[model samples]
Target: MSVWLPTAPCTPRTCAGHTGPVRGRLPATALLLAGCSLVLAGVVCVPVVMLLGRAPRDRLIRWWAYGVVRAFGVRVRVTGRPQSPEGAAHTGTLVVANHVSWLDIPLVAAVLPGRMLAKSEIRRWPVVGPLAALGGTLFVERDRLRALPTTVRDIAGALRGGSRVVVFPEGSTWCGRGPGGRFRPAVFQAAIDTEAEVRPVRIAYRTARTDGQAAGAAAFVGDDPLAASLWRVVTAAGLTAEIGVLPPIPAGTLPGRRALARAAQTAVASDSANRSAESVHH
Candidate 1:
């Protein structure tokens, strides 16, 4: 599943002739420029969040994410909004979404206010790693079976303390060209233990232009290198991502973690399919 990830712009072979290819290797430059702005935003906002409070921090983080997405030339069109918890505090809620590309993080963060659960390996990625860590992302070491219980407990404690967390139960990214992988039920345990509300968010990518395809630009599928993916995104014109924040499924209504995960996955999957079909019809 791993490839050398050559830094070449996506060509006709991969993206058809609809998108521009900004010379091979130049993708890194575009990404670096985008990264710089985001890093600066992160630097400034992290402090504000630390010195201020949750509401201020969440607002700034949302603005920061919106600015970054815009700076990168990606237009985001948001659909439905998330349901705020009824009587529960903000931390007593969990947000789950479908995974498509690395951009998904910023895209979701742009609207949803919370820390995300990411793989532990992401902590080592250049530029992004530090920002994520400073942003208070919780790293999950999924490969270790023994660590699951402790990690779940930690997350439960954080939730009970009023931490709204985002999780991608898919475990892997789908190309956005097909149905994504299923959501894992394990993370739902945190929501269950804390009696948190679970919200479903669906992200779908499409072309800005009526005649183009944005899959190559936005999807981070198997073996797609970070450099190449950036090239595709920067070069592609009229790329739009639509985020649909669906209703929250009351955790109390679900039997347990498995039931919660199933309901969420079904809701997300159904929404995603409908969204894609709508895009095609329009």
Candidate 2:
């Protein structure tokens, strides 16, 4: 298999077993409708959003993302200040995070709205595909190794243009249960080339239950149908998504792409451990 198309051991049947405090059918249906409506509204406004200046567009995008997550009845808690605040004049930032669920995309965008690094297949997905393209997502042809360099070049160009680019370096979605896939070094090359700051963010899904365990209903892993995942999320009660923005790593400080990737992976992993310890203590 191509390195770009990494797979995770997490399967919906196995890892997606925690359906914490599910809501009644009527409420779940209402939440699902509201979430889908927000998504459609975003799709319809894309053209107008594209015309707006960077700052306003980013602000609107962040607002829309927050609404969508809330519409699904998911509570959001974000910690740590973003190295580059939205709408601020800054150098290119390569925002890297560990993959957990499909919700991770919007969850991160709510805090750091940027051009996303996504699999090329997402461009073909209904509703979302068109919205993603219109929002300036950077698609990767994960199946083709020969296209790797070209993808890196495109990413570097975006960074050079002073655009924040969000990428899930894990290359696949993990269950948020343990250590995820290693940070694939390819995307880090873009940061190295552009000397962009790498902001490592950690995304975790937890239930509001007294146990405070990871929310498995949010996991979108192997062979899970999109519809099933969506229903799972809306029906799951008290699901909270947490975003932990860690310290930024200057690419110039790292000698090579691999080192840069390792540094980011360590930052995310270390934060996860610290959070887990705190959870246990509490």
Best model number under TM-score: 2
Off by over 4 Å in 1: 1-35, 43-45, 83-91, 124-131, 208-214, 272-282
Give the lDDT of residue 175 in candidate 1.
60
TM-score of 2: 0.92
lDDT of each: 0.71, 0.86
Model 2 spans with C-alpha error above 4 angstroms? 85-89, 125-131, 210-212, 272-282
Q: Model 1, range 91-141, lDDT digits (tens) per residue?
A: 567889987788898888888878788778889988777777877788877
Poorest 10 consecutive residues by lDDT, candidate 2? 273-282
- lDDT, residue 161, model 1: 84
- Deviation from native of the Cα of residue 226 in model 2, angstroms: 1.0
Each candidate: RMSD: 5.8, 3.5
| lDDT digits (tens) for residues 1-282 of candidate 2 | 998878899999998875458899999999999999998898889988999999999999999998899999898888777756566436699999999898998888898999998889999999889888988899999999999999999999999999999999888899988778899999899988888899999888898662655678899999999999999998888788888888788899989999999999999987452352211101
Residue-pair clashes per prediction, in order, are: 3, 0
